[model samples]
Target: MNRKIVVPPILFIAFVGLIIFFIPMKEAFTFTEHRTENPKVYYLPLESERGFQIRYVHSIHLSDVFETYEVTANQKIQLLSMQYEDLAIGLPGSAEEGETFSFQDGLYTLTYEDNVIDSFVLLIGDVDADLAFRYLNKEINLKQQLERGKSYAFSVTKLSYYQMLRGGNLNDNRTKAA
Candidate 1:
């Protein structure tokens, strides 16, 4: 009933709440990199997706990805050695090139030619998720296909202009009013 007593505590609580609300949370932010045509990369944040795809072009896309099946699929699979430090990726087991394996939540038909297990589809679902690829006359050896790592040899938290504008506040489902 006393304004003097009640208002001061209410004001203090409101002030503390305001301070807490304004502070930026690390988990609230996400990052992604978009490879632009030029050296300047145009990065951005992602809202949501069930999954995504990856590709390897030219010769060696990254030092980690391959030009052929240099690391024997059998050997790696046998030894249980993942290609990368993260367990989210690895290669499939096969005795021949055209072997198809379920990789990264999608179907991957790979080719084991030119000393590399280089190209494959990055799928998003158990079925009907892979995008069509135009390999032309290239041999598609699915047997040597490997699950491409999430890092794609390297993953940086992407903050695009869109994400920078939103400041990670958009995706946060918390009821904290802005």
Candidate 2:
């Protein structure tokens, strides 16, 4: 009935409520009914084979009329980036995702089914030495072919007008790879 008694209790409750709201509670980790029942389907790999993720391009798009895809080397590989027009026009291929096509940029080697898929797109604009895939992996550039599910890595600055060609990081000793 007194002001002090009622006021203190109310203030304490408000403070507790504010604290609970500010802090991130356990709801994020808690499993919901629907999520538990309907799990997303994922592709499984062979017992001995090691699969990489959709590496190569996280997401690629064309000017509007063309089609795009997020193809990876393996289950472990995920597309990192596409410098120019990631957009592509399908030339046609076998049942495998592998197909021949052209790229807006002059440089780059896209792999598929453990082989480098040759890509020779017409030069859209001025061909700059730096704007070529030769900067990434020489073996996987427009001239050469790349296989799908193979691991490859390189650091290149897309903004630069010219990029120097260099050796690629490949462990294939028997064959000459980038």
Candidate 3:
């Protein structure tokens, strides 16, 4: 009968719709812009235990500083190490408890133990710092994608497909600075 035929089609359509809605809800490393009427959200597919690095030039020292982090299975960010060239202002002169500091090849490295956080805010340099995000061989010049002088929050979370579509995935584009 018509009733049976219609019911099956309706159920099929509902199932497809649910799949569409949930597919892009997968968790990712999401970067959300702050202090704007309309905040932009950028996301990248991230697997637990994968590592990334943020490299930037110190405004005062003008030297390269690299900070490495890992995504924990519990969706936390763990500070793995920090490499910098300055012992000047704003730089840690000595390691705190549970951290090891050493100098090698013109750079100072501070490796941490259990330094984890739920999220962190990244402030783009308004004056002289150039910040970049590196994962594997792929690099995203965050200074180019985000507004200078603004802050963006980084965390691991889920985002809708619409939001992901509107945001930039620097991995797909090649606007890398030379």
Which candidate order results from sorting by lDDT in descending order? 3, 1, 2
TM-score of 3: 0.84
Question: With candidate 1 superimposed using the best TM-score fit, by how many Å does residue 11's alpha carbon deviate from the native?
Answer: 0.7
Of the candidates shown, which would achieve the greatest lDDT relative to the real structure? 3
Q: What Cα-based lDDT does every candidate model obtain?
A: 0.29, 0.27, 0.80
Residue by residue across 55-109, what tens digits does model 3's lDDT show? 8888788998899999887788999999999987777878999999999898899
Greater-TM-score candidate between 2 and 3: 3
Clashing pairs in 3: none
The clash count of every prediction, one per candidate, is 17, 29, 0
The segments of candidate 3 whose C-alpha lies over 4 angstroms from its true place after superposition are 6-10, 19-24, 47-49, 174-178
Instruction: Give lDDT: candidate 3, residue 41.
Output: 75
**Model 2 lDDT, full chain set:** 0.27
| Count of backbone collisions in candidate 2 | 29
Which candidate ranks first by TM-score, i.e. highest?
3
lDDT, model 1, position 178: 19
Per-model TM values vs. the true structure: 0.25, 0.18, 0.84
lDDT of 2 by residue, 60-108 (tens): 3422122222223332222322233332444222233543334444433
lDDT of 1 by residue, 52-112 (tens): 2222321222223222222232211011111211122344444254333333533233442
